[model samples]
Target: MFGNVFKGRKVLVTGHTGFKGSWLSLWLTALGAEVIGYSAYFPSTPCNFKVCGLDKHVTHVEGDIGNLNMLTNVFKKYKPEIVFHLAAQPIVRESYRNPKLTFDTNIGGTVNILECIRSTTSVKAAVIITSDKCYRNMEWVWGYKENDILGGDDPYSASKGCAEIICNSYIKSFFSDRKNLPRIATARAGNVIGGGDWAVDRIVPDSVRAFSEGKQVVIRNPNATRPWQHVLEPLSGYLWLAAHLLNSPRLHGEAFNFGPDHKVDKSVAELLTDFSAYWSGKAKCKLVNKRDNRKESMLLKLSCDKALNLLDWSATLPFEDTIRFTAEWYTSYYRGKKGMFDYSMAQIKDYTNKALETNNAWARGVFND
Candidate 1:
């Protein structure tokens, strides 16, 4: 019930076919928003979008964000008041294989969006999704704040950092006039895991695929640690930020990090253990003891203090709950559960209940009950 912020609003979500995008689209639709989705290539077969039958739920445009003509046409047609950009070459290992693809999609795509925003008049706020790896990680026990240095070890991470830079550049050059230009901000979240993520390199997807396939998950960098959160954690932040942006321009052109509580940080091995537990030990992980050839951060974390202090948002689910929700969704999916769409909506309602019961500010005054 996010303050009825999305009620009757025309919202556009680039990459709406991805795992997190699909979830956000459904949530926004539930809030009475007219959601329009634009995506280039369907990332893979058996994607979350199709699995949930989301194509029937929104006006899905199959096109690339890099194509200014196509993107501008969507803007002109939908006249969306809010936009969320999540399209990217989102894999780090894959980034190493093709840095140019990563750069072109992550950085150039942002440029095209900003260009279209300049030409369009309907967009009032945009929240671009980046990653926690945007920080120049030193592996300290402490978390990285929004002011921390923006750098990355791998191509994927580096591309995100560059994307942040591009956002700042466009905001400074074009959107600096708060009165005339639309509000824009960047969001960085921890390693996101949930159901319907069929990506190759992600731990949750890999574990689920391995367990479902009756194979051992060969986990590389078993000791690497990351701040992990359910996909909802960051999506909630985006929703609130967009709502806030429409109301307050002070947050315009800013960046905020949305991560799990500090206590929730875990290593690869630790999370794999939870997967095995939730799957009745059917999920197995074969740990690789050797160092990874690709450059990667062993420890990555984000400080959510800015979001908590300024936006009054914090993670409502605990680490165990995050894993439980994720595992349960996959289990039910594998079982050929009916009403999977309704089931997904149930998860959102359940999470909202948790937030309301916890007195989360974003939840208290929102939604037309």
Candidate 2:
């Protein structure tokens, strides 16, 4: 389904060793993109990038996104045509522990990437990846629109919100309306669950941690609801946005939310139940009794109509299938299944192709039926 979107293109993906970054790197490589990755070392010991053999495939540079000199050097050397900035302190709980690092990495790193892009001449399209939490989460019932006021409750969320502001500032101060300048867009997506992600404090990885050890997975907020989708779902949207931005400058200077259909909206306990079923494990969690009742948005969803209408993309797999595929991958990997890498690659290819086929089929059916 990637087809020739990335043929012979130099794509720079930050945070390539992280969970989403590892998946994006593999997808870009498969699509024939000459990929250069710049980010800090693997956040954890057993990183997804190492496990998936991604380092061998891409030209990975071990450096900090906060280091502008290193970033500038990489930009001058690689001369990337497209850029995907995903570097950040992604953990919410850890953000509480280390707010300063979160701001430096998330907010400062975003500004650093923009400055690097501004200095470079060859880059054409830039996609800054933010989080759904970037929206001024008001603890309301309605889904977040792109125009919603930006705010954050916790350090991680606030940093992401600040990153969005940085993106907007860069676009306004320099990139916007500048001829021959790169088209820049910011993307916000929901809680993503997928295979090969081993990040701490994340729901899927936490579930994997407990399930693999034959213990009950601890859920921090059992009733908290989030807009959950497979990792590939949002990656598909990001790729679509990147491709669209390459040809459509009208799409620049805008923020788009990529997420699943509303029917797939789920609570933490419901997700754990599905996880237990898919992986054959007992799932249980206690309601947290922490005193720092720094309010967390119980229900945060995004309206992805812009992405659907403009980019011609939608989440193909339902929430059940998303969880099932994720659990299956981890199960197969832990069980020493033959062709684990091959199997995971096959899953990506199969799911991506199927989504494209479904979307095209729906479009064709609109007139034929």
Candidate 3:
């Protein structure tokens, strides 16, 4: 999808060693873009980028996003034409343990990115990735729109919510009238499940951890339902939105949510069941009876109509395919699929081709005007 859009473009990716970051880095390389990576070390054991050998493909710079001087130096050096900000403390349960770090990384790091952009004056487009948890957890059944109130209960979620505010505030206070500055937009995606995510405290990772260790995973809230989609679903939306904003700033400098449609909705148990069906593992899960108040919303949904109308973006992957592909990835990797690095690169190649075909068809019809 990005092969044509990013050819010869100088793109800087924050969180280049992260799960989504690794995938995006590979995609940009496939598209023939000169990629510069800026972020701290990989955030977890069995690091996603190292496992996938992504460092060899990117200009890896190990640094903190909170350091203004370092980030500004990178901006000045790379002179990036587009930026994707995905660095953050992304886990809710982990947030409960490290609230301060979460806030500092998510919110403060965002400020640093925008500040660097303001000072460097070379960037042309930027996409700040937040989360669906940015929405105030009302525990309602309705889907959140771009204009809905932004807030959160947990540190991770609240930090993302604060990041959203930062995006808007910076846009209004600094970049709104600076036509030469990069156009900025924020993207909110939900619980993204895929391979190479070995982080503790997340459902998919927890499940993998258990199954790989011959132990059953623990179920905290089997009934809690949030918009679940494959990682590529939102990444596609982000890439498309970035490309659109690169061309037309006025129509794209707002917030957008990207996730599977209503047909993809499933309970936690349902997702696990799908995974188990693929692997046929001897894993089990029991509901926690105690009042385990983790601050996760029981129900969170988002409407992508605004994105569809404005950026001509949509979620093209189905839930079953997501689950099957995810399970198959782990299965193949465990069975020694010529290293996890090639496996991840192969998945990226396949998914990017599929998304390119799908989006090109959609663009022909949607952007024909």
Candidate 4:
């Protein structure tokens, strides 16, 4: 997997307690990397980190990314060879409630990580995880490309856009020299959904909560469309991109979009209907027409052509399989299954098998560069 690049490597994952971060951390460990996780705090109570007992598998550090001193200390102590920066204020609705915190963490925290990478000689490659919302959304029919304008109206989206700008500036100002050791790149992924995600305001988590309690799931912006893919899709791109960066410097400071094919783009209501099919209980949604002060994009999409062309990476799961894999995981967890760590690992294995069946470049350990 990934040309055995991560095997026996020292990998550091920031925000390992969050949804996407936890999954990435576990995958790194499975790849035989010595994984270290740094995070300010767990974003949610029943987070995947705790649910899967990730602490037992990796070195866990608790600190705010905004605190440069603490974050720098972790970098010095760990001396990680590869870094995946996933720490950020990831919620859109919460950003409306606390814009300052969002800016501080998303922008300031990203700066701190770049500074650490700049100073750390042990680090050789990094993948900075941003959002598809980082694009200045025109709500148009077409998907956003890598060179699209960076701007956002909402605080969360704006902060992510600002993070991308900061990363670009750092790359140009500091890491521009060909002699620079740490080759850093940015990844923008579509809305990700999978198991063990219990964050507030996300459609999957909200649906899981409502279904577990036998209540009607509240539908907010049901007609809105998004490029939805399983969590493993983007994670594969990040891993493959990082592996290639270790040997290919031309990709440094570049940005890539990892999203599903255009055929997978679906409305929120459609996602709910497909997700409910695999649910064990009677799953239903109540569409509320109440006015929402917080603004969300009506349509969003990403073009993964860059990733496919440059890294030979593309999303493997279709719409139905994505929903089935997500719904099954949550249902099994809610049914009080033991050893969730093993269960999660099983899902990873299943995803890998699918990738191998399709002969995905990453699964075949084929590096395009």
Candidate 5:
């Protein structure tokens, strides 16, 4: 797995208390990495980090990414060999409510992380996780590629675009020298769904809340289409890319998209229909044509050709399996299933086996060769 590059490595994951970040940290611990997690605080109640007991497995540090002094001190003290920057205000609707905080945390926080990486000599590789919304969405049917123009009408999307620009600037100005040892890259992933995500305004969590109470879930945009994949899908890409960046200088400052195949694109309605099948309780939804000032992209997708060709990485789960994985997790949690940490780890193992069966470069341990 990941060419065993992560084994015995010192890895720092910012935003470890978040949904995607907790999963990534758990996976790193399984890979035998000495994991250090830094986050401002738990972003939500019933947080994945607490649910999974990650604080026992990794060194957890609570601090804001906006505070350069604290962030820099962590880098200096830990001297991590690899960094995965996932820290940010990650909700779209929340961005609408607090645009200033969104911009400050997403954009300014990224700059602080980059500054730390630039000054810290112990870091060998870093992967900055940005949202797919970073692409200036034209709302066309075609998927966005790596080189596409970046702009966004919404604050969250715009913040991500600004973060990307800042990363590119830092790469070219500070890390571009051939002698520079720190290799940095950015990853853009589409809508990620899996267990342990309890964020506000997301479909999965909202549905879980409603279905548990035998109530109908509200559908805000039933026709909007998105590229949905399991959380492990993108985490695999991030881990693989970080390992490669350590040795492949040409990959420095590159950006790659991790998403499902275009054929897997589904509307919001279709996803709920499939999700309901695996759920045990009465699953129902009510669609309302409510008008709101917060405009979301009607359609968005990403082309992973670069990830496939350059890094030999691609999303491994089919749509059915992705939904099943998510549904099973939430259902089990609701059923009062104990040992969720072990259960989540089992899912990671299952995902790895599936990837190995498909001959994914990272899962087969072939990338190091």
Candidate 6:
């Protein structure tokens, strides 16, 4: 929880209009930080940014991360002390439709962020978010560590892998010994599912859309196993990593993987089943034999030993709670609940409360007074 560390500090978040970014923006505000966001637009209609009224809390700027001039202007205006770079073409299926955009955004956009950080002087810490797919996934049964091979079969995954490399390159080439420059680090996370994510091709959103329409959900790969966790899981890691990097410059240029417990790895169908049980809705999955030419790993997992050992971070939310929290959120929103913003804040409070009460390292002091 490092609420004291962020209080009154200027923090910049790219992709703040998105699901994960919105939640993080709200969290940073609750921590008493002055937050600013720069992204093109909200990718989905019923996204968490609008659901939680994040725009009211953050100075939301509409811009592209690939535009160096635009990003430099934002850096100059905000003069942020810390940065969270989440802007990217995230969807794997969508990347197949437009691989060029994916490569440019993920790889080139990272270069742009590094360029701005290189030129700026107020920044003390920066966390660049990449996917667990950054690993050259061997479809192994065990989990992939941060030191694992960097490779991917799909454009989205490969682009993230390249982004990781680009961050490291920027560090060695420019930021390695710059005393005034910000310390840069990268975070890799597992499949993150949460409320208000209506992106196409994503399992939860696709299922929610179907169930809302009174139709069954269709999944391309029911048996494919993934290390699924709530969005807050990795966000917590990123926040903690950034806080630590501010003090420990040795952590700069390093990477960490934040993922759920190994025992919680479940197939695609298992997750949807849990969602149905939580919502008390008739959720049936219509598994089809058809497959997209784009290849996703059949079995993917991440080992967070490095994070736990180094940053003292862990996944506090269990597998069932992850599903329940997501389902309850969508159910409340669709049922015309009055306290969308309040309920979301309450969930954040509840999660943090549980973590702190249980003495979880990540939530120890994140709650505001």
Score candidate 6 by lDDT. Answer: 0.86
Each candidate: what lDDT?
A: 0.87, 0.83, 0.80, 0.91, 0.92, 0.86
- Model 4 gets an lDDT of 0.91
Predicted candidate 2 versus true structure: per-residue lDDT over 1-369, tens digit per residue:
433567789999999999899889988887789999987889775677887788678998999998999999999999999999998889888988898999999999999999988888999999999999998887777678898899888998999888898888889989868455699999999699988888887878887877777776657667788889999888887887777677667788888998999888898888878877866545545555343366466788888887777666678898878888888888888787765556768888878667767763222222111
Model 1 scores worst on lDDT over the 10 consecutive residues at: 360-369
* Candidate 3 regions with alpha-carbon error over 4 angstroms: 289-291, 353-369
Tens-place lDDT digits, model 1, residues 1-369: 667778999999999998889999989988899999999977766688988888888999999878999899999988999999998889888998999889999988988988888889899999999988888878888888899999987888888999899899989988898876489999998689988889888888888888988888899889988888898888989998888888777789889999888888898898889867878767767999776756677887777899988888899899999998899999999888977788889999999899898888778854211
lDDT at 23, model 6? 84
* Span of ten consecutive residues with least summed lDDT in model 3: 360-369
State candidate 4's TM-score. Answer: 0.98
How well is each residue in 181-293 modelled by candidate 5, as lDDT tens digits?
A: 89999999969999999998998999988888889999988888999999999999999999888867878899999999887899888999999887765898897666464
Clashing pairs for predicted structure model 1, backbone only: 1-367, 3-366, 3-367
Clash pairs detected, candidate 5: none
| Per-residue lDDT of candidate 6, residues 1-369 (tens digit) | 664689999999999988888888888988899999999888898778888887788999999988999999999988999999999999998888999999999998999999999898899999999999998978788889888899988999999999999998999998888454589999999589988788888999999988887788889888888989988788888888888777667688999999999877998878877887755556766976665545676889888898878777788888988988888889999888976788888888888886786676767743211
lDDT tens digits, residues 1-369, model 3?
A: 432577899999999888788878877886688999887887787777887787787799989988888988898888999999998888888899889989999999999998987887678889999999898978777789989998988899889999999889999888876455578899999788888787777888888778777787887788878678878778877777777666565654588888888777788878888887765656666656343677577788888888777766777677888887688887786666767767776876676566667764333323412
Each candidate: RMSD: 2.0, 3.0, 2.1, 1.1, 1.2, 2.4
For model 6, the stretches where C-alpha displacement exceeds 4 angstroms are 178-180, 289-293, 365-369
Provide the TM-score for each candidate, comma-separated: 0.97, 0.93, 0.94, 0.98, 0.98, 0.96
